[model samples]
Target chain A: DAPLFDRVAFIGIGLIGSSLARAVAHHNLARSTVCTAKDPEHLEVAHGLKLTTDTAPTIAEAVRDADLVVVCVPVGAYAEVAEQLKGNLKPGVILSDVGSTKTSTVRDLAPILPEGAHLVPGHPIAGTEHSGPAAGFAELFIDRWCILTPPPGTDPAAVEKVAALWRAIGSWIEVMEPEHHDKVLGITSHLPHLIAYTIVGTATDLEEDLKQEVIKFSASGFRDFTRIAASDPVMWRDVFLNNREAVLEIMQRFTEDLTALQRAIRRGEAETLEALFTRTRAIRRAIIDAKQA
Target chain B: DAPLFDRVAFIGIGLIGSSLARAVAHHNLARSTVCTAKDPEHLEVAHGLKLTTDTAPTIAEAVRDADLVVVCVPVGAYAEVAEQLKGNLKPGVILSDVGSTKTSTVRDLAPILPEGAHLVPGHPIAGTEHSGPAAGFAELFIDRWCILTPPPGTDPAAVEKVAALWRAIGSWIEVMEPEHHDKVLGITSHLPHLIAYTIVGTATDLEEDLKQEVIKFSASGFRDFTRIAASDPVMWRDVFLNNREAVLEIMQRFTEDLTALQRAIRRGEAETLEALFTRTRAIRRAIIDAKQA
Candidate 1:
């Protein structure tokens, strides 16, 4: 395969960041890869794992001469990263990201883009419940959809280049509007995580022995939620914080729908419950048909 | 290990039933094992898989001459299963079940149990998302929990016999009141499944392109819900129908809590959202510590 980028710099070496770094390194998608995280320990792990060709000590140093600088940090840190990278990026460099929400990302990072540099915000719709550099694998993004919501009038060549990089890592790329991406992901990713967090929280408040029983019997259904709820607290905290409006808007619809079902359940409305369940099975079937199951 | 019973009969040979049959067959927990399902195809699979020593087509034929009979059908099928087995069961037979709900088990099965027949209800809280006899494995219950909700004045020997069988299959047993068992499972099992079904159902209502995208991008978080929602619809339909009150009650709490978080997200109440996400993380830890993760 042709090298997709001359060099790629990773701004934060956590799960998604590390996964991208690993994929870029493993598949030789880039001629060389370098990464830097805010935490020294994480950088040390990147060094130990040989996650990239170089582990830079600071974000600016990492982006200094790279053709592609992918911001892989929490969205909450977008401004800090953008501020730090504003001056050091090479001319014609491409700035992209794997943050969950795109609108907030553009709001925070676009104004700071250096002249002649291109900004393309992307979200690779892939992750495991596990986090951190070690948790990353080359296949994490394989066959997954990566949404790139570049602002209109952005250089087509830059968008193509970034799209080429993710495609090299085995993702199908689609261009979407920033607002639409947020609204859609707010329903699919953000709301699901929020529900998992809340239900697990409800389980936590149970009496001690009952709580143990909940854990013991978790395989019935709660195990899935625990795995999800175990995801990096800081990162998810940033997600729910940064994607506030869109997340909340969709969440409103979700709650209202949930309440109607709840009332039906309370009234022993088996038909209502069964109808919903049967409809969901069709979605699962669609996922299987899409081969993303 | 001591053999727990002279003969064990299983009514309704689906995933959970076939798994218990496999466990019994593997561990030599009973002198003989027999199973039957209302669906002939499932019974044929049970026989073809050799999940039991004997297979019958009727619930009455299944329990006749047996010392122990476990009802492994859907909870909604309990009344009919109990009614069918009422006159056909041998004297002193132990009638138990592996239903998700407990209160309804007693309400449906207890009265129909014949004199000298012991009713020691049970729920071996282990399963996979898959269904049917072919999907079962002997290790399904290993290191999982088995909760027995024997009503007051229920025969202790019958309860012990069931517990011993589960123990031989590598389960830790908990004896609790039927109502308490239902409540804990309402949070852990029933509510989780309902939410999974609901969210997956919500995504099912999306526009064609968006729905396709939701499935293609499911790995973001929606994939887990798909797996859960892919679970046997009929089994789940019965679970919700039979466990109506407990599931609805807990679902009410879940929706209210979800609403508050939705409000936080809409209002951009970062603190409220972060705090709950943080608190939920602690529960995931507790579950992991309990070795349920």
Candidate 2:
């Protein structure tokens, strides 16, 4: 079968970027793939791992003749990278991303897209606490979700091509508005990561002995939070910053709920505590039924 | 070789209780085991599963001639269970438990302990979200910690026997002051559960459509919290009520830390967010080093 694209370009070879590149290469989705990283070390690692057919030192050089361009750096670096690609992209190239925050992606990349290019912003709801080029794998997106939030009026062929690539890589695709994507993920992904980071950070402030004991006895439950909190710091910082409004709004609700729970604990409201705990189990069941657990 | 104890009695047969019963049988840790539960349905399930060699109709009947009595109910029920055990306990019997809060275990069971009887409170740092006899396995405690918080001046031989049984069943043992155990676990276990329950509960309040979306996309991070939050509600309710002081204090610290992070996010203080996130990663590394992760 013919390759899906003549040349696919990756702007940053980090965890998500490298994983997608590996999937494309492993599945023969692209005839040729080239990746460039802001960190030369990452590009070197990519070379050593043969993560792509080629490595470019600069974003412009990488995307020069590419049929599909994937921006894969931290979300905060989007504007700078977009600046370099302003006039370097192929005329009809499909510009997509594997970013966490969809709104920021569209805002930063859309303005620089050439007249004939297409912008199909995507967020693959898959990752691990581990990061960098070495941490990615071809199976990272298997059976997971990939959400595409193309701004209205985007070419159907362009969006379908992006979806087809993700589907070939073992992802279920869902397309929604960029704003709605941020809101849902704000609660599901952003809030959980923020809380995990906060609780683990709190433990960091504990007395040295107590802190060590917390780690020693962490299996009970805290270990889960520590794992989540250990996710890429710069990536997460960009997520919180770029999705600030939605994150803050959802966080407000979380704080209010937490305060209520804290009060219930204080007043010895056993029934209230049990009711909430029991109710939440239904959500777990739903996730299990959805095969998302 | 002879079993570790002549007769071992369990006062409840939930997840932890049934697991211990299975472990006891699997390892020949006890010659004969009998279990009783406040809920007849649980006793019936225990009977159906053959969780113990014998199933007793009441606490008194269960502990009448047992050499070791392990209370395996929620902390809130300790006072009532202790009342039933006050005079019926075999003379010189070693009374232990697998409760979460050690201070409450000591507080509730200490007074009822006969002069010659030993009070050796234990808290096995192991469990899962599932509850009841069907959810237990003999290997649940393997590689897990079993903490013994026997009050000062207790019989050394009794404590050693308890430790020996846990070791035989594949657990590492640690002895600490009850207060210290409660404080450490408050941060490690109790606070984490509370936060998980709170966040999952927060999701439950979202609109029905959005709520379904949250569950569908939960693998991003919320799924871990849901699994933790799905743990037996009555058990966790009792945990929070019994370990009020320690849980509340740690929760206070957690809330303050969360508030600071919230302000940082609101103000776009990317460095502060990244710094805290990076620090928490060290704890995860420490846990991995300790083989607790």
State the C-alpha lDDT per candidate: 0.85, 0.93
iRMS, model 1 (angstroms): 1.6
lDDT of candidate 2 at residue A288, scale 0 to 100: 90
Tell me the deviation in Å of residue A288 in model 1. 2.1
Kindly list the per-residue Cα lDDT of model 2 for residues A1-293, writing each as its tens digit: 99899999999988899999999999999999999998798789999999999999999899998999998989999999989999999989999998999999999999999898999999999999999899999999999999999999999999999999999999999999999999999999999999999999999999999998898899999999999999999999999999999999999999999999999999999899989988999999899999998
TM-scores of the candidates are 0.95, 0.99
- Candidate 2 residues lying further than 4 Å off, grouped into runs, are none
lDDT, residue A63, candidate 2: 94
Sequence-dependent TM-score of model 2: 0.99
True contacts kept of each: 0.70, 0.92
Q: What is the two-chain DockQ of model 1?
A: 0.66
**Candidate 1 residue spans exceeding 4 A from truth:** A1-3, B1-3
Candidate with maximal TM-score: 2
lDDT by residue (tens digit), candidate 1, A1-293 = 56888889999988899989888887788888999988899899989999999989988899987999999998989988888987899998999999988999999989988789899999999898778889989898888899999998899999998898889889999899999888788877987898899898888777888787787778789988988887777788889888788777767667667777777776777777777877777777777788787
